[model samples]
Target: MPDTPPEFSESADSDAVAEDNEFDSLRGILADGVVGAAGGLVGTAMMTVVFLIAQSVGAFELTDFAILMELLGLSEVVPPVLFGFLLFLGGGMVPWPLLFASLKAYLPGESSPVSGAFFGAAMWSGFVLAFYTGQTGLSLVLYGILTLVAHVVYGIGLGAVFDYFETRPDSIV
Candidate 1:
């Protein structure tokens, strides 16, 4: 075995580094985008829920809620909790699963946390902003922080568990 050229080894190392960097950068972007969308969905759900409850209890003007709902082609009043959960699940888990699955195809060797932290954080961000829109409250900060953490944990945990299951010997992403 003749001595390998230094240039050959250096080039190979650079290629590996570049590849890793690209992979990380892509994952980061995907993670961020998924989180953002999830947050938005949660916020929207929260707002809609509030509107429904307000209408039912007369806390929010019926005319306004009705008009909004009618415009959206929704004719039914929905439970706030249902909306909240939908928003939470949609924001916290929807994107991650898709993102994780897509990433698996490209980066099967990459590490993705099972906890739903990513979506949680992102959804929480949107939730905070939406909740605080044109309003001030003492619990705003607390709710915001809690929302973020809850969503993130859910997202990360879900991811971890998902990955765990997917890691079975015969599993395929």
Candidate 2:
């Protein structure tokens, strides 16, 4: 009786809506992952610089990268310093933001600077401190103080960058 078939029209409309929803979901995931990765990389970079500066200034004499490689018995390849930087980039820089993003839903407090600082402290105490202490026999008092400060700085940088990108008018996440 009508020019359009009823079944075909209904199915097509439903399909279009379904497709749109799927696309939106995928877009949200991509946006969040990209923004989080960017934030993590930047934060790690800042942390590395601060640590290096402190090391040069004779704050403490320990190399996390070297200790990690030695602990894993991988120090024979190239040099420990080179491998340490690579490990720091891959292990340290890449994971923080991703972990933060994954745990964003459960992270206490709003995603503000204070919250970021707290997150950084948690990360240092929970992960970094333990690792260094076990692997390198780090001085709990000295190394802990340095790492706590550095991790807090890193967290602040990560949070600031993520907030900036997330709040942009065209941000998709």
Candidate 3:
């Protein structure tokens, strides 16, 4: 028999356990960022579906894409719609996810999805103000409702992706 009991021998101090956890390592942090980006991309796709449906019904326009094209002056270089979409996807896949990850701790929720939904709602307020299309009457109302729903859906998708990765036994996060 060993001198130390197996139970006590393998036990670690709280500090050691905390230090040894995945998030403390650089590799783990990078892994989490990649995972978060994937989640954000998924979320963006979900939001795009909502916008596409709205566009089909004439309730919405590709205002964001147009704005991006104008701001970047990429209209002459490439098709405004295509360039705008690529930019949008890039934005969704990186910065937004990074922001979400940074703020996840402060957002109120029992799970990532709930917190993400809150984050999306918060983001929508800014978007509504910044991207106002001068819509009025019922058009404005529909736009508001649809955009809000889309943002919430995006958050859910983002959070679901995080939740999925986190639940895996071999997850880096």
Please provide, for model 1 over 50-138, each residue's C-alpha lDDT reduced to its tens digit, 9 standing for 90 to 100. Answer: 44544354333323223333434553666444454454346334554555445544442245552334444544565455444332353
List residue ranges in candidate 3 displaced over 4 A: 1-26
- lDDT-superior candidate, 2 or 3: 3
By summed lDDT, the worst window of 10 consecutive residues in model 1 runs over 59-68
Each model's lDDT comes to: 0.47, 0.69, 0.83
Total clashing pairs for each candidate: 19, 0, 0
- Most lDDT-accurate candidate: 3
User: How do the predictions measure up, each by TM-score?
Assistant: 0.43, 0.71, 0.83
The better-scoring model by TM-score among 2 and 3 is 3
| Cα lDDT over the full model 2 | 0.69
Model 3, 35: alpha-carbon shift in Å?
0.7
- Segments in model 2 whose C-alpha atoms lie over 4 Å from true places: 1-28, 126-140
Residues 1-173 of candidate 2 have per-residue lDDT tens digits of 46877766645687667655754797777877777777777777877776776566555444656766776688887588668667766765567777776666676668745566777888887645434533233444546677778788888888878779767866655
Candidate order by lDDT, decreasing, is 3, 2, 1
Please give the lDDT score at residue 13 for candidate 1. 78
